[model samples]
Structures are given as C-alpha cells and as structure tokens.
Target: MPKMIFVNLPVRDLAASTTLYLALGGTLNPQFSGEQSSSIMFSDAIGVMLLTHAHYGVFTKRPIGDARRDSQVLLALSVDSRDAVDATLARAVAAGGRADPNPAQDHGFMFSRSVEDPDGYVWEIMWMDPAAIAGTPETA
Candidate 1:
C-alpha cells in the first residue's frame, strides 16, 4: 500500500496562512481549502492542514495548545542537500518565518537547521549523506 502523511496546524488566520505557505513553495489542494480547512500539498503524499482553532477544537475535547507561546508539535522535513536546506529556509524566512536561535549542525554526514513558521510551529529542515547514514551502524 502507498503511504501518506498529514500534519495539521492550527492557524489564527486561514487565508494568511495559506498565502504564506504558497510563498514557501507549497501547493494547495482545492478539495481541502475552503471555509473550514486548507490542505497544503508539500509533495506527492505529504500535506498539511491549516485549520482554524475553532474548527480544530472539534477534533479534541481539550483546549488547543498555544503554539505561539508553547508548542503542540515540531515537524522536520528532509532535503536533497545542504544547499537545498539553506534555500528552503531562505524562502520560509522571506515568507515570514523566524530563524532558530541555535546554529546549524553539520555532523559530517548530516546537516540540520531549524525555523519556526509564522504561527510558531517549529520545523527542522535537514540534509543527509545517504551513504554515510547507512554506514553509521549506531543509527540502526
């Protein structure tokens, strides 16, 4: 079976969120972008749902976590190379995201940089040398 991943993020303004995502090179899925939610297609099988807090509240009886002050989750996406990571992050910042206070880590085989989206959702974009990763038996 094919695999898919969905990441849902609560946003204060759906329209603004959608615009920022598009600016970051994310595509829109019309079937899910409407009065309630916007499905942003990042890749063939990866998508994010920008749901209003009230709409997202329906999914849980508990109150929504304050992503601006705190965080419900942090997401990380991988890229092809270190340059790709840098470029993607540049786009995000230009689109209104914040740079992580910490510096990037280059561990010979892997490189990672973190950034927070406009709503304060954290994302770590990393690039890895597949051969090095595979050779690192400890990772297994």
Candidate 2:
C-alpha cells in the first residue's frame, strides 16, 4: 500500500462522533471501527480516527486540550460540487452537530463551508470546478 494519512481526532464521546460522521456519507471499517474508537473511512486511506478522550489519552500522556475551548486542528475535505458541502453540513446538523458561523466561500469557481463538529473540531467542505479553477489563475 502507498503512504496514507489518518487524522486522529479526540472526542468526548466516540459513539456520538461515529454517528455524526456516518451520517455525513462516511463508512466504518469494522476492523478499526469499534466502541472505544472508530476508523471513519472517508476514502480508505484518508480516514479519521475518532477516539474517546479517555481512549486517546492512552497514546498521549499529555492532557487533551478541549477542542471547544481551544482550536487544536482544522479538518478540511474537497468535494466535487457545492451541493456536496451543503449536504454534508445538513447531515451534520441532523446528527447533532452544528455548522460554523462563517458563510460559504463562493467565488464563482469555488465554494466552501466550514462546520464545527459536535466536539468543536472545524471541518471545511469545499467544491472546486476544474474548469472554473483553471480559468482563475489566482485560485490555481
């Protein structure tokens, strides 16, 4: 297998986090997706490992900062269309999550929305039409 990246995110409640992602067009890898932590399969290689705070602490001896209080990381994913972004945020809201305050970044060619998961980690869902992107050298 080629090199892959897995974003490890700490959550107060693993079960809730799992459900939230599952609602947003994500699948679970039973091998790694379980009670304590789950491998949120976005595209096989690019997966989000949502581990409970207690479970995550086992790996990191340091205290886990509260994401709600402090921003530790920002998660972003590029999609094929703007509708995909709205769909994801809609599903997130239904799954007990909230969309961030920022409005969608629609620059004719590109569109994006930043949402805050229930646990407060930010995620950016964006769509860029290649033709539009190619035309805009600055966006390139």
The per-candidate count of clashes, in order, stands at 0, 0
Q: Which ten residues in a row have the lowest lDDT in candidate 1?
A: 16-25
Please, what are the lDDT tens digits per residue for candidate 2 over residues 1-140? 87789888888888888888887777898998777899988885788899988888889999888778887776788777888889888988899787855677888788889777778887888888888757666666
Tens digits of per-residue lDDT for model 1 on 46-122? 99999998898888777777777876675788888989888888887877778773478889789989877777787
Clashing pairs in 1: none
Q: What would the TM-scores of all predictions be?
A: 0.85, 0.88
| Alpha carbon lDDT of each predicted model | 0.82, 0.82
What lDDT is reached at residue 25 by model 2? 72
Candidate 1 ranges beyond 4 A from true positions: 134-140
Q: Estimate the Cα RMSD of every predicted model relative to the unseen true structure.
A: 2.8, 2.7
